[model samples]
Target: MLKKIFKQTIQINQIPKYFLASPKPNFPIDKIRNFNIIAHIDHGKSTLADRILEMTGTIVKGEQYLDKLQVEKERGITVKAQTAAMTYEYKGEKYLLNLIDTPGHVDFHYEVSRSMRSCSGSLLLVDACQGIQAQTLSNYEKAKDNGLKIIPVINKIDMPAAHPEEVAENMQLQFDVEKEDIHFISAKTGVGVDGVLRAVVEKLDPPKADINKPFKGFLIDSWFIKDQGVVMLVQVKDGCIAKGEQIMSCAFKKRYDIFEVGILNPEMTPQNSLTAGQVGYIFTNMKAVSDARVGDTFHKPDEEVEPEQGFQEARPMVFAGLYPDDPEDYMQLEKSIYKLALTDPAVHIYKESSAALGNGFRCGFLGLLHMDVFKQRLDDEYNLDCFLTTPSVPYRAKLRNSQKILEVENALMAPDDGLVEHYEEPLAEATILCPKEYVSAVMNLADERRGEQKEINIVDEKRFKLKYTFPLSEIITDFFDKLKSATQGYASLDYYHSGFREAKIKKLVILLMGEPVDSLSFMVHERRAHDFGKNICKKLKEKLPGQQFTVAIQAKLGSKIIAREEIPALRKNVTAKCYGGDYSRKKKLLERQKEGKKNMRSIGRVQIGKDTFVDILKN
Candidate 1:
């Protein structure tokens, strides 16, 4: 029966023999460790995971199996959190290690937070050379808040510039750990990694569980598969979940039969049952994309259990429009986005139509990196090309008559200036870690972006941490890139929404041929409205195709035009046929052509191609 089910689910050429025959091991709760590795980007979390997998005989040594997505391979970053189960014999006893490898980028903080919930401990990896970064600190705080036992592991100790001693000292101050508590290892070369593994077995507490209670679990993550509906990675908190069992989601309130229960030993290996303290995947009869909530709790249909405290839904911070280059691909793109959103729930998608770009979906993401990665995944995984518009943040508008507040995520959704009492923009508190030498540059960059310094602390003799609060709109666009540029790529930033503040902001509208383009309109501060209008008008003048008549590009604030530019009409010499004709005949031909151009300008509609928007949006 297992073989038959495997045959139905497997899309590959052939199913692996071991998947069909591998015996399930029922390890005791005390012998199991549920933990995750958390660190900043490029801090060697995946490398350390690979080493751990190899040492435990889960897979080959050089296989970077943690990051399975194509975008991850191309970008060399983990965009999603992945899990692996390993069997290791420590001393004379065997232990079951369930490890979740989390992304370090701040854009995926939701992923990190969700992964942390299923684990009882975390390996806080830090780079020896780069010291502590802003994300590292942020992740550390999350781990602390989750009540996870954190092990300070300093990686890349073998590098030429590596200062394990200094990094350890900084960790001591930041994390309040003793000298002996810190573990130094080079993840690349595998030096002292074995000791780190031993530390995991010894220091980290096993997950607290009781198999005698009713079956209960919460989904840590989930993804859709072609042949097999939705596969969920769940952490069983009590009792057990088995194949052919009827389970119901506490959140969705829908029942599903467990088609298969398995653990990813880096690969899907079927297990008879997943008990308390075990992290494994469940195959269900869920076909709808919305059926599998990422953090929903599940329980036996016959039992009444209190629902677990599931994760708070991720809120999108940045918004952008994603329209297919060809309108026919809209349905396909919509399907692809729904499928992708299963794995990434933070992206908020809604139907939006643009006057400039036509039919598309306006999507919201956590940050710029999240938006870029989502688009790249669409291209790489789904073979879909999308025309993306300028990213904007959600703004608040107040109606003057009723004093009702409106959330304006898309520029088209924003009300006219007269309809508002005032506008309030979202603010974010940014935490930056940088070398002291670049402090002045960082400060200047922050000041230029209307940031107010909140606090500055010296991390060490040569490094300091700067905290600033700025309008979320300011940092959502190229602020991190500019920060890196000013700090010579040595600065790391992490931020969180800091509520909304009133500001002198106005809606900047772009009109083409006397018609407003929804995609080109945006909200800007009153102080920078003129310059932004001028720049946008200039950019449109260059990218917009010339029409039969002169095309007027104008940026308007309320009733006043702040900036204007014009594109010359594509003209043809109507009088070319008469080389030696009378001057009056030539003059009459010119006047007729001019009248035709004028009539065309008044009646004709300009069509902006996908390439034009792409060029204008490119940085």
Candidate 2:
């Protein structure tokens, strides 16, 4: 009878006192602050977040989480956005601190932005010594537009050449914010963490919500554990929410019987009714997670209307053509993509038919890093082994006579010579901010990759802004790697698609022996046709096995195969002493290798081994 009474006492909407500190009848929501820690990759966002979490006493002292998952800790970057509930006692009243930690990489920009929508303020972390980079400014602008009050925090204060003053100065000169507004802290050493915590509680106060009415909560994130069933991490905005009842996800209006409503101390604990300015988890009967999305809302059983535009569908900005390395794994590949889509809805895939590669699909993303993460997720999470073709931007073209609109990703899909009257390729307005001594080096590097100088502004004698128009196709290629190399990693660059422009580009196919190797084909500008073919052939030559007969490689324009090379034949008489066995056995082993080489289809005299395509498309 006592056990039954205790179990029944914790209602569906009941939240524990720890998760949501119960307010008196007159308490207001203005004492709360909801914000996120954001920045470019390796800008100390995660370390700083740890400091805040430690300082606020949400987690114990000297108990660093390393983040919530293995992947996040191993990569040293935030893979997803996570919200933690913390309380700060300052000036007598306890202020609630709800902090969201986000990924700094550009690939997860949508996730970062979506998380930002829930935050009323953002702590913009920047590396003190490295100064500001491209992604830093981009996320900063996004947080600003989301109505998030900006608190610039110059991280890594303990570094040898720490430049808190320089980064502050750069923030003032570049982004047009007051230098005095930013905060400097070493989340690593827990330096100045108190100031950060106090500032968050004092300066960035919360938005108002009426708690006297019925409950309305926002589901910031939801997941399914193998053994635990379905779980939701939610933020209660108004009134009170209870467990043991049915609730609906505002994004889909899908209902679930609330099994339990609780707090997460790295684990969920049953609690009572959750009220305004609170964060907690809810276990529900809905298992598939088809109804919920990040940034979704949860409401009382009766509310009908959803958010105006529906849940904003995240669209991938970068697209890459993908193929199963071994055609037999097609079913495996399909299942892998579908499973990954469960957690990451942004990875979009569509069926594609290519003349060279045949049946395949095009995967879309926000950027190259986004594409890399998706592909890596397939390999790491889903265990799908596949080969990727060289990535290229979708090109827009029209037929000369019929004027048919065509979007081309694979070079082989590009129409014949006379068919294309005009083609427009995507262009990016790129910005490179760097020191004056490296400005010439950056400019030369940009020029080498076919960038047109748009403008150049001298910020100071030592700092300058170099603007350029670059092809999106170039960006997906090795352009970024080259920029990093040329600038000695000093130049900070950022580029966004401006629009499409007329392009003088053509498809260049690499032929092994006399037949084309489909995956090696790429779109190359008129002047770069030879260079593109040469680079691919050079990499392929190193990867392909040696053959009995001379193997030739050539650059082809469809039916016309031009520019050729040959891998010289194997020696008729190899050294007998090299092998332990007799000459005949050594000859047989060599003969087997030669047979394997012959079995592979050759473009002319060039033979491509089975492993020729691995990491060929990667940097």
Candidate 3:
């Protein structure tokens, strides 16, 4: 009887009547502030978000808040943009605040862009000690581009190295932000976070959306949930959407009946309707995952609205092959990739097969870190063992005979020399902001990577911004790491895609035992082809284990072998039994061993193990 009563009590507590039913609160549009927090990585973006949630009582003092993703917790950085709706009472008046905490890494700039579009204002947080960095300028520009009001805040003011006044001056000089408008606070200690929150309510203009118009919302982010179909986080720009309403996507031209409409109190809370100027989520009972896109527009079936402008489809800049370690798990890996792609629309993937690696997906990402994050999520979320090939950037090749151009993301897709003319590699305009002390080192590093200086602007006596245009292929691999190292972690870099430029690019192929491996081939600049071939050959020679017969590794440009290395066969002690015998006997034993080795080499085939492939790719 006691156990039954206890179980009943627990069940009752779990099912709140208010939570089960939809909430019907009508918030004035003029009183709602839809904004996001923007900052450089490790400049306390997440910490400040936590404080905002705490101050608004959206979450309790000790409750675990944003940075909810497991990978985010481990990395101590925000990977995805998370939304939370909070109601703050100031001077006896209640105001609804919709906050989006976005990732600071340059790789997730797309996420920042989408978040910026959904908001009317932003809190531009800067570190007091570190001052303004590269991403600070990049994110600020994005917010400004979206016409969002920016509130400058100096974070980490409690630290011993805190220089709030200096950072404020830098902001004033670099961004032309008025010094009087800047706020100084330590996000960790909640010193002045409340003031920042109140300022958000006072300074930023309320969302200017027409609630009387037809229901139309911008799908800022979306993902699939098990048993729930597709859920989209949308910012209502006009009118309202409610649970059980019929909605259609303007981009996909698909219709669905909404299963639920709710606000993210960090967790989805059922709401009767999300009115204009409010940000919330809608669950469509549609199983087709492709119907929902990040930047697509959704509206009621009876009311059609023009799709929002400035919403471009996310394009993948880096390409690689993702294969499972175990070939039998190919289908599982494919399913995992599909599921992950549903959540991350920026990641483009299609089926691919390799002779050595079996079936996999040809995956494309925004950048190197984006690729790594996708791979890491695959391992951590889906529990699949995956192997990734070397990353490459997309190139546009013009055909000589037909004058037709083809965009080739994979080297394997490139046409042979007989059909190809010249290749145009993608170029990106990169901006590096760093201290003056490390400018020379950064310049030298950029020069080594074939970067052409475009311009240089002095920020102040202590810092400056360097602009350069580089082949995306050159910096896609290790350029960021080198830049950080050269600047002693003080440099921050941002880049955007520029148009393609003609280049002397050649396909560098790696041949194992005389057979060319298509998976091992990559495109390289003609000037560095020899050095790239030599380096890869050396790395492969070290990675490939000794086989029964000598394995010859060669790097080739067309039919010409540019670099060659050999892995010696594992030798047995064939002459060990002749230790007590004469020198002639030992020579005879060695001769017999050599003859056997030669026989083995005649028909031997070198087998490249999975570890060898991983090592080569990692190097």
Winning candidate number (TM-score): 3
Tens digits of per-residue lDDT, candidate 1, 428-485, equal 9889999999999999999999999999999999899999999998898889899999
The parts of candidate 1 lying over 4 Å away from their true place are 1-24, 401-404, 544-552, 566-614, 617-619
Candidate number with the higher TM-score (2 or 3): 3
Clashes by residue pair, model 3: none
Q: What lDDT is reached at residue 549 by model 2?
A: 66
Query: Model 2 over residues 360-457: C-alpha lDDT tens digits?
Result: 67887767876776777788787776756556677877788785879875565788767888778888878777778888888787777788999998
| Higher-scoring candidate on lDDT, 1 or 2 | 1
State every prediction's TM-score relative to the real structure. 0.88, 0.76, 0.88
Model 3: lDDT equals 0.83
* Ten contiguous residues minimizing lDDT sum, candidate 2: 10-19
lDDT of 3 by residue, 500-559 (tens): 999988788998888888778888888889999999889888877788778888999977
